[model samples]
Target: MEAAIKFEAHEEVVSFDQEGNVVVNKESHMSKKLMARRAIEAHRERKRLESELEDYYFEEM
Candidate 1:
């Protein structure tokens, strides 16, 4: 047997199997936003690291 739950606040639907394992119906909006934010943060960190390395290389010259 399967059971489903809906969150009215976020309008997200979640399901569960008889064994109590969560089953995702679809990608949630919040998750998409979170992923985007994380991607942006990662890109910024990469750029910062690159800049620091370049500065250090120039200083050593």
Candidate 2:
């Protein structure tokens, strides 16, 4: 299997390439889509953590 790495910008994947090689324009679409998905997932995780912290603080009060 080829190891893949992605570069993202502005919530878009600007590039995706196998390790040790450069990615070109053709790979940009999928890379951007993956980047967007990852970003959304990260946002959700942050929200969950904040909610948990709020609950914890309230319980301790």
Per-prediction CA RMSD (Å): 13.2, 10.9
lDDT of 1: 0.58
TM-score of each: 0.52, 0.52
User: What lDDT is obtained when candidate 2 is compared to the true structure?
Assistant: 0.55
Give the distance in Å from residue 41's predicted Cα in candidate 2 to where it truly belongs. Answer: 0.4
lDDT tens digits, residues 1-61, model 1? 1233335334433544686444453565557665556556655666699799999999999
Off by over 4 Å in 2: 1-30
lDDT of all predictions: 0.58, 0.55
Which consecutive 10 residues in model 2 have the weakest lDDT in total? 1-10
Candidate 1: stretches off by over 4 Å: 1-30
Q: Model 2, residue 55: displacement in angstroms?
A: 0.2
Best by lDDT: 1
